[model samples]
Target: MDELVRWLGVQLDADKARAAQWHDLECSIHEHQEGGLLKAVAALEVYGEVPGAVCDCGGPARVLREIDAGRQLLALHLPTPYQDEGDRWPGCTTCSWRDEMDDLQVRYPCKTVRLLALPYADRPGYREEWRP
Candidate 1:
């Protein structure tokens, strides 16, 4: 459970860094062109906007929004320590979903967290068991 949490944190950090890089690239392009290309393209209204046009660039924004959503899900579904007799087990606070095998409440790093981590499956330390 601790490892999974760390892995998710690393993935989120990597995503944030990528989003920042994309945003910097967009800013550099806009600064270099001074919106001249965007203005001309908007005037034509044929392509509406270039694939990464500064006028309608949503690449970084979209990625950042997705990151925000992932963060929100992580915040909501947290690892809670529950004492069962003399032992402690990690459980999910917001995960009320039942497991198909036994119809019992899912454990920590539940399906929601697993789904959120799906995009980073290729990253190091991601286990196949984490799949939803």
Candidate 2:
């Protein structure tokens, strides 16, 4: 079995016209609507200063970057999945746990990254009212 499959995230074009629709799709795909795992898409931006202070990862921030449209933007893949089977996944950045949220937020800004609940069997595994 492919190992990265469990840590996969898709980067789709963000359509201004279909922002909500794309988000719904993102929720379906990245969150592993099937039985794989959660995925994420991030838009890269370059700034002179830190976006915000994160609980120092015991080291300096790992400034990562990705290329799009022939331009390099600073971004990194979120190390977590966003869905689960039987409504329970493993790991903090990968599970649907309340405490897991803090782990992600500290590294990836909540506003910049989104959590989609794509589950297997063509069903979404997210709760709109649930905040974690």
Candidate 3:
């Protein structure tokens, strides 16, 4: 697999993990009666700087929604191998637009995927070149 494709997958996986963690926390808080300690933990601004901080103001439902959206977007922009002049290149499934001059398909990890990965840029394993 291409390095960029691998990197994008890692980023998306990281997002899912974070969302799962938040959902678990939310569930625990709701299920248990920890009193002030749980309230204080929930009130903390740990995720304040993170994009799409659904856990801050909403419950597990919101975090699940975000996770579903990410999954759908990733599904739409999957990396596919295509043949061009006897050589195979990675291309995007949903980005079928052709370049005017080259008439070639958009490369894998297309603009949509790049933008999807943008929110997790602060996380580890993010590359500067991956910015859209």
Model 1 over residues 35-61: C-alpha lDDT tens digits?
465332222243333564343446678
Pick out the ten consecutive residues of candidate 2 with the lowest summed lDDT: 58-67
Cα lDDT of model 2 by residue, 85-121, tens digit: 4443233342223454443223221212333212211
lDDT of 1: 0.69
Top-lDDT candidate index:
1
In terms of TM-score, the best-performing candidate is: 1
Relative to the unseen true structure, what is the C-alpha lDDT of residue 131 in candidate 1, on a scale of 0 to 100? Answer: 89
Enumerate residue pairs that collide in model 1: none
Worst 10 residues of 3 by lDDT: 24-33
Rank order by lDDT, top first?
1, 3, 2
How high is the CA lDDT of each candidate model? Answer: 0.69, 0.27, 0.64
lDDT of 3 by residue, 47-89 (tens): 4345544443466457667767877888888876565675356
